[model samples]
Target: MEVDYNKISRQYDDVRSADLKLISLFSEEVEMNENTRILDFGCGTGNYADKLQKVTGAKIYGVDPSDGMREKAKAKNSNVVFYKGNDKNIPFDNNFFHFIYMTDVIHHIPEIRVMFNELKRVLKSNGKICIATQSHTQIEKRFYVKYFPTTAKVDKERYPDIEKIISSGKEENLEYINSVTYCDNQLVKVGKEFVNLVERKGYSMFHLIEDSEYKQGLRRLKSEIKEKELELETAGGTLVWFKKK
Candidate 1:
């Protein structure tokens, strides 16, 4: 099931926030500076874009398809400009961006090839594109999957394989730079707090699951929390890098 960002835009930031460590990693990898022109592709709510601009003082632009999401992003009053656009039709000129980054967004794109081509069109020569996503192993290892098993199946179906992403980029003449996996040592919510987040459908997978399945999973989760202190593991994902040559 496709998650509706327009409907969830208001509450999207209630649970989701920019990960500082990830932003720092992105800054270092892209070598962003005041002169850098960065595009945050599929930048939902402009969380990372806003933070990155503050961290590196880069000239940043955020493009997303959802009007509501863009509205929420614009509310931030940051230097990063937000635009209503998508992979097929980016609202920018050729070779305009020095770097492009997408965070946990590739799975939402239907045409990976089209997105790569579009990225290549807007990215300057030797500019980099960074995709932050979870590998199949990482998806299976997600904390809530044990309770909501269907989420794992759904994610596996939606998210392209890591090698497939690389090959797709190569098809567009984008050179594969490298891939790295990182984990933030911070603990996710625990016990009742975690249950509250799940109940609120903090993750998109929660919205995809059937109502019956979600209820069942919630019951199981509640039972576990009652039995023992449930603490979610560290947050992590893989960063796949490609360069426009």
Candidate 2:
């Protein structure tokens, strides 16, 4: 969906802050220390950047095209540098970053090829670029796909393919080192929290479809859940990680 991120920056972090598992996985894969320079690409509110900085004592940098998002991130932590940059042009010197991590924001980027080149340009030799994103293979079987059918179409068209990432990695001399799948749905009370989340329209995917469709799907979900009157589980996504060859 075409988005005006400045309008959503305030509420964005509230919903996104649900999972820290991705951050843990990143710390495990990317070697971190006091002197390490880390980049939180497409950082929404700099929440992860702030968390990472504290966890590893690394000099952290976050980049996003949204001024509102950047400002929010900067407000969270002044120590971490926040930049306004895009997919084709990341305003950084060559071999600048020891590690880079982007999650859930890959599909939103408009320039995949140029961004891949930019990644290669700024990333240090042997530095890992960890990408946590949705894959086409997972979409057909996603639990929530039934709720909002159009989401599958939107996601399939936008999400970068694994093979393509590997191909780009090969062309960029980056390695297709490792990858994994994650079931990211948070368990919540079906009657309350679950419905509230849907109402908040926290996910950008919710904004992709028409309001009528969104309500239709939500109504169905709520009806089904009120029958159970218990907890609900949602969202399934996959993650892929690559390294500099």
Deviation (Å) of 30 in candidate 2: 1.7
TM-score for all models, in order of appearance: 0.94, 0.90
Q: What do the candidate models score in CA lDDT, each in turn?
A: 0.89, 0.79
Tens-digit lDDT track of model 1 for 10-83: 78888788878789888787788899999999999999998999888999999999999999999884688999
Writing each residue's lDDT as its tens digit, candidate 2 over 1-245 gives 57678988878776667257777878777779888988888887888889888878999999899999898888888889999997887889999999988877888877676777898888898888988787787765556678889888987888877777667667767787877877646664556565666787877778788888899989988888778766546455666777776
Worst 10 residues of 2 by lDDT: 229-238
Q: What's the residue-level lDDT of 215 in candidate 2?
A: 93
Task: State model 2's lDDT.
Answer: 0.79
Q: Worst ten-residue run, lDDT, model 1?
A: 184-193
